[model samples]
Target: MAVYTHLGSERLAELIASYDVGELVSAKGIAEGISNSNWLIETTGRDGTGARYVLTMYERRIDVTDLPFFLGLLDHLAAEGCAVPATIHDRDGAACREVEGKAVALIEFLPGVSPSEPSPAQAHSAGRALARVHLAGTRYPHTRQNPLTAENSAGILARFSESRLAGIDPDLPATAARASDIARQMLGGLPESIIHSDLFPDNVLMLGDEVSGLIDFYFAANGAMAYDLAVTHAAWAFDPRGETIDAAVGRALVAGYESVRPLSAEERAALPLLAQAGCLRFVASRTEDWFDTPGDALVRRKDPMEFARRLEFYRDAGQGAFA
Candidate 1:
C-alpha cells in the first residue's frame, strides 16, 4: 500500500481554497488504487452549487523527478483529444503542489465505471486507445530506463533465490530462475518507446461498452511497444481458468491497433517473449508484496500464481497463439 501522510480534511480544504477552487463541501478517502492516497473532493460554489474533483497525495515509492514526465504526457494526450484525466492547475499554474511535505494534485473527475471483464469489442477499442497514446507520446522529451530491465530481474532473482515456501507451492524459486533466463535473453532485442506498462481492465474506465478513459500513470515509462501490447494481451485475454487465451480477442485487439499504426516484423517476433516478461514482472512483484508486506495493510496483494499460470500458458502455446 502507498504510505500516506494523511493530511486531515481541514488542511485539505485550506489547500483547495488556496487554489481558489471555492470551499470544500466534503472530502473522503477513495478506496481504490494501491500507489497513492486518493480522495474525492466536493467543493461548494458561492451560488450553492458544487463540483467534484479527485485529489491525490503522491506516494513516496516513486521518484518525484518522474512526476513532470507523467503529468506532461497526460497534458499532451488530453490536448491531443485523448480521453484522460485533466490535471487541475494551481493558482500559479502549477500542476503539482506541496502540502505537508508531500506532492498533491487535483484532477477533473472522469465519469465512468470500471468494467469487471471487458467484451472482445471493448478490448479492441482499448487496444486502439493504447496505440493512440503510444503514438502521441513517442516524441515526449522525458526518457527513463524501464525499471523492469534484466539487471533488475537478476537482482530480484538473487534476493528471492533462497525462498522455498513463498506461495501456494514451494517451487517459486525455480520458476523465478527460469523467468530470469527468459528475461535476460529477450531484454536486448525489443524496440523501445513510452509505454503504459500497466494497462489492466481496472485501470480502464468504460462508459457502456466503450472505453471512456485510462488512468494510473504510475507505471508509465519508456519501454517496448510490443511489451505494451503483451501487457494488454495478458490483461484482456486471460480468464480465471488459465486455459487458452481467446484468439478472437487477440485478433480484435490487433486489428484495432493496426488501424492506427502497424506492427513491425521484429515486434511481432518479440511479442511472445514480451508477454512472458510481463507475466514474470507481475509475478515477482506480487510475490514480494504478498510475502514481505504486513497483513494489516490496506492494500491486498494479488495471487502470484495467477500470473505464474498465465506465464505457463504462454510458454506452452508458443508464438502460434499470438499469430
Candidate 2:
C-alpha cells in the first residue's frame, strides 16, 4: 500500500471545488499501492447525487504530460464495453488538474471487491474480459510504447550485475539474460493492440465470481495481446512465494482468453516466451525497487527474487510449465 503525498483538508476542498462534483464530505488517504497517493472521496454533489470517487495524485513513475493518453485510453476502453473507471473532468473540460506540482484526477468509484484468493472461474472471466479489452482497443486513437521491453530488461540486469541474488542456486542473472533474448525474438511477431500491460490479479475487481472491473491502466500500452495474457499468468498463477504455479488457474486464464479471441499458432508458441519475459520484467522492476525505494516511501518492497524463482521453474519446465 502507498500514500506518497499528503494533502490538507483545505487543499483537498480546493481541488474538489474545481470539479462539478458536489462539496466534499470526507476525504481519506487510501494506502493500497506503491506508486501514487490515492484518496477515497465522498461528496454530495450539486446534482443531488451521492458521488463516490478516487482521487489519485500522480507521484512517481508516471508522466504528467501522458495523463491524457492514459485517461483517454480508459475512456475509450469503457466506451468499447470494457469495465474501466470513468474519468471525471473538471468544469473546464480537463480530466487532469495540477495539485502542488503533481497531476491529479478524480475517477468514478467502481463498486466491487478485489479477490484475495481468486478461483479458476474468476481467472477465466478475467481472461475473457482481457480479450474484449484488446479487441475494443483496436479503435483507440492514442498509443503509448511499452517501457518494459527486452532492451530495458537487459539494461536492468546490467545495472545490478554486481549484486548477488540471495537464496537462489545457480547464476540467476544469466538465466534472466537468456530469457530476455528469447522473449525479444519470440514476441516480435505476435499481434499488437492496446493491452492492459499490467493486468495482474490486484488490478482486476470481482463482483461475485465474475469480473466487475479492471483497474490501474497506468502501464497500458500498445503491445502484443499475448504478452498481456502472459503478464496475467505470471501474476495470477503464482503462490505467495512466487515459486509454485497454480496450474488450474493458469489453464482457466488461457482457456478463457482463447475462448473469446483465439490465440494464433504463433501466439500460442510465443506464450512461454512472453510469460518468461513478464516474470523477468517484474524481477527487474522489483530489484530496482529493492535498491531505490526511499525509506519514507509508503509502499511495499516486493522481493525481486520471487520472480527469479518463477523464472527458474519455467526454465526447467519450458513451455509445458503453463500446461
Candidate 3:
C-alpha cells in the first residue's frame, strides 16, 4: 500500500473538481518513493475526455519553504525544452495549492520507465542532459547554499560510535576514519556550481535507449558540479557488486558532458576526490537512516561500498580513464 500524510481520495477528488479539470476517474497512490506521497490521477475533461497527471503531496522530509525553488526550477527547465514534468496550474493560475493542509501540485506525466541499471550510452546521455540543465539554470532566480561542511563529516563519524560500528561490522570504525580523512582533505579543493545533487538512476527515465526525462527535483541544489557528476557516475558507471561495469562507459559520459560545457582544469583535477566525498555522504546518510529512521525495512539503502569502489577506481586510474 502507498503511504500518505493526511489527504484522502475524496478530498483530492474535490480539489481536482474545483479546478474544473474534469470528473475524477481514478486516484491511487504510487509506491515507488520513500520520501513523499504520489498519486496517479485520472480525470475526464468537460468534453468527457480522459487525461492523466501526477499529484504530489509534500512529505515531512523536505522543508516546505524549499518547494518554490524546486517548482520554479522545473518550470524554467520545461520552458527551455527539457523533458521534465510540466506543472499544471490551477483555476487561479497557480502551479501549487494548499489542499488538506498539505502543499499539492499537479504535473503533466512524462511517459518512460526508470532505468534500473543504465548502460554506458545512457549514462553519457544523462551527463549531457545534466549539462543542458546547468546551462539553462545559470540565470535562475534562486541560489542554493550548500550545508555540507568538514564539521558535518566529523559529526557523522562521531555519530557512528564504536559499539554501533562493531554491531554492523568490525571494520566500520576504520572505514569511517579513512572516509573522514578523505572528506576533510578534499573539502577545500572541490569545485562548486548549481547541481541536481541526487541523480540516481531511478530519478532518470529512459525511452528505449535515450534519456526521455528527469524527475524528482527534491534534492536539487547549488553545490559542486563535480559532485553531481560523481553522484551520477557512481550511480550509472558501477554495479551493485561494487565493480566498474565498463570503463568506456565512464569515458563516454564525460565526453558527452564536455560536448556541452568544457570542464575546467580545476574541475577535472577534483573529480576523483569529489566522487569520493559523494560516496562518503551517501554512506553516512544510509547508515544514519538505516539505524535512526522508523520503518527501516520500508526504505532500501544502496550499498555504500559500491560508491566507495568507484572512488577507489578514480583515485587509482586518475582522469586518464575518463579522458
Candidate 4:
C-alpha cells in the first residue's frame, strides 16, 4: 500500500510480462498504507480487453514464507462468494513472483472507493460482509497466529525512550502501559476463526452504502472472532482522532453483524476489553512507524495519538461504548 521501493516503467513492464495478465499499460504507485509497496496496474488484458489490478511488492512486516496463507486466503474467500479480490496467478500457476529479492503479486482490482466518513448504513453493510468473511474463512485450512498482540506490542513499546514517547504525546507512555495491563487481564476463550484483524475503513471498498469488496487481508490470521468484531467496531465507531463516538453507527454495525452470526454471551461481555486491545495494538505499531518510517517514503505516517485517544475512550466507556 506504499512505494518504499521504486520500480520504473521498464522494470514494471518486465515484471508484468511474466504473467499472462498482458503487457503493462501503466503502473501508478499507491501511497495510502505503510506495510508493502503497491501499484495500481493497468494491462491490455489476457484476452485483448483491458483490465486493472493491484500489484503489491512485499516490503517488511511480512514473512515471505507466509505469502501462501495471505494469497491463498484471497482465493478461498473469492471462491466462497465473499467480496474479496482474488490473486492473479502467474503463467506458471504461481501466486507470486520474486523480483530481485522481494516478492510481488498481482491482485484482481475491485471497483469502489474507500469511505473517509462512513454512515450507519455503510457500517451495517461492512459489518455483515465481515461476518461473512469470518464464516467463509472457517474452511481455509492454513492457520497463522496474530502477530500484533498486546504482549508482542509491549516489546515494541519497550524500544521507545521516555523522551521519544513524550515527544509524540505526553499521555502516550501511560496509555501504552494501561493498554498492556488491560489486554493481559481480559483473557480470551471465545469463538475462534480466521479473522481479518485489520479491517480499517480504508481496507473496505464501498459503492454508495453497500460494501462491494473487503481488501487488505495482510493482517488476517487465526484468532478470536469476537476480537475481530471488536477491531471493526473500534475502527468504525469513532471520529478520525477517536474523540467522538458515532452512536448510531456503532449500534447499526453490531446489529448487522448479529443478523448474520450472533455473538455468544462471552463474546458480548468481552467486547470492551477486546476493543481496548485493538486500540493499543495500533498505538504501539503507529508509534514505531512514526519514528522509523523514512521521511521521503511514499506513505503517510499515521498519528499514533488517534488510537491512543481510542484506548482511553474504551477504558472509560466500558461495555457502554458498544451498547
Q: How many clashes (backbone N, Cα, C below 3 Å) per candidate? A: 0, 2, 0, 0
Write model 3 residue lDDT over 131-191, tens digit each, in one string: 8887777767797665554346557867777787556556456556767677667655444
The residue ranges of model 2 lying beyond 4 angstroms of the native Cα positions read: 166-171, 177-180, 293-300
Per-model TM-score versus the true fold: 0.90, 0.92, 0.89, 0.91
Q: What C-alpha lDDT, on a 0 to 100 scale, does residue 7 get in candidate 2?
A: 94
Evaluated against the true structure, the overall lDDT of model 2 is: 0.83
CA lDDT, every prediction?
0.77, 0.83, 0.74, 0.89
* Candidate 4 Cα deviation (angstroms), residue 71: 0.3
Q: Listing every candidate in turn, what is its Cα RMSD in Å to the true structure after a full C-alpha superposition?
A: 2.6, 2.3, 2.6, 2.3
- Error in Å for residue 158 of model 4: 4.3
Q: Which has the greatest TM-score? A: 2
Sort by lDDT, top down from the best: 4, 2, 1, 3
Off by over 4 Å in 3: 45-49, 148-151, 187-192, 293-302, 320-323
150-256 in candidate 2: lDDT tens per residue?
A: 66876786665544543332456666556447555654767889988888888898998899899999988889998899888888888977878899998999999
lDDT of 4: 0.89
- Using lDDT as the measure, the top candidate is 4
Clashes of 3: 0
For TM-score, candidate 1 versus 4, the one ahead is 4
Cα RMSD for predicted model 3: 2.6
